[model samples]
Target: MRRLMQIACAVAAWASLSLPLSAAPTEPENCPGLIASRDALVSRAALRQDEVGLTFVGHATFLIETPQGVRIATDYSDGTRPPVPPDVATMNKAHSTHFSYRPDPGIKHVLKGWNPAGGPAYHDLTVQDVRIRNVSTNIRSSGGGTEYDGNSIFVFETSQLCIAHLGHLHHTLAPEHLKKLGRIDVLLVPVDGGYTLETFDMMEVLRSINASLMIPMHFFGPSTLNRFLSSAREHFPVEFSNTAAITLSRAALPKSPKILVLPGH
Candidate 1:
């Protein structure tokens, strides 16, 4: 089954990266064919965990602590990881900011996107209640040249959260890219406004996908942030926050689309 291979591949996928071996969590069942998988449900990650919380360390970086005491981290940095090991960690090869490892003994699985031959490296796989996949988009170099670096979109099924991290995304999402994205709950988008792509092009990408929450990343400067907010505000409400981490649950999600901008800590 697709789920089995993905679950099995989950171990092998991120093997090339460096992280604490004990941080990976046990792969959930009904993976590829998650019955809970819904297409039009845009809800917050509201899974009630007895002793868990989610934290966003930085650009495309997140820490998801599940109800079973399972903590999954995304794009962990070597010197930036928490003192404790996460049950699982997801990383992309787009930039150095998205990958790192600590010599911890409590972590379990470390996942990385697969680089393709003459194409973007995309490591697409699904875990128990988690689905971590990638879409290959053209990478526009500083001057010229085109490098195909795969962009990964991680979907947390149980949380009803389909999050797409545009790792140095050069172009807009292709037809296949949208298909893979399914239904994005919270999109971790980059807001260079011009550096990455023209505001018009970026707007098209935002319009193409119907994600409930659009979380901006990759850009700093108050003006840059303001530009992003202004551009996105046309389609949805932009809510800024002082904290990067949010405890999301399905029942507590927004009824309409919203943009949650968490402060960079």
Candidate 2:
């Protein structure tokens, strides 16, 4: 009986060693250093918790209002101004229409996407109720050569959501860029087939980011917007909103990825 028990124990040990090791559980992707607790968020006004308001202000600009009443304007330019001065304004120099030489004096923070000193523009700061950061990308120069670090992809973190604005993105993202961006809940992309990336390449960018919601911007007109929508519909459902603004929350995000077109330029 003792010898039989020893043989059984040896067999069990061999089987355990022969079996393949179980794979480690995968961790969910998230934006680093952006998550904030409810206690950390300051309630400044009537906006509900975990809610953000976004309004298209024509062209590539959009006005973002946080639950804490913090206001931000993207691609801020003289032509596309918000109803009032924003608390913070983010600008890109891809075109004069995407940036302003002189922003409103009342604006508290003016973040330029490109460095005039000839390097990548860097911005990582926290305002009243949100944290804003940037990942630099290249743009096409006048001579048609690669302009390294000429553009930036600005990200806003608030109300438990990460929103990214792809400013004149000229190319598909690399793995490193995706790593830095982490998990984006909403993506504001430029869909002009000519000025920015072509339709197919822009689609590739959309796929790589894989945000829960996508808002198209920078299209010249209906023809341009239609061209992008037709291509985008093949991969994701497209929804048209009659209103120019929308409120979003983490709990209300679409179950599947979707493209939401707001009525604006």
Which candidate number would show the highest lDDT if scored against the true structure? 2
Q: Which lDDT tens digits does candidate 1 get at residues 1-265?
A: 4543333243332112100011122322211101111111111243343112446565556666555455666666664565467767766555666677453566677765535355555454445545455555666555577655544555454344445566556688887777655666556677777656666677788788766556677675677878877878888876654344554544344666677776652
Per-residue error for 255 in candidate 2, Å, reads 0.8
**lDDT tens string, model 2, 150-225?**
8999988877888899988899999978877878888999999989999999999999988888999999899999
Count of steric clashes across candidates, in order: 25, 0
Deviation from native of the Cα of residue 44 in model 2, angstroms: 8.2
Root-mean-square deviation of Cα positions for candidate 2 versus the true structure, in angstroms: 16.8
lDDT of each: 0.55, 0.78
Error of 2 at 104 (Å): 0.5
Stretches of candidate 1 exceeding 4 Å from the true structure: 1-53, 101-106, 116-128, 141-143
Off by over 4 Å in 2: 1-46
User: After best superposition, candidate 1 residue 104: deviation in angstroms?
Assistant: 5.3
Q: What is the lDDT of candidate 2?
A: 0.78
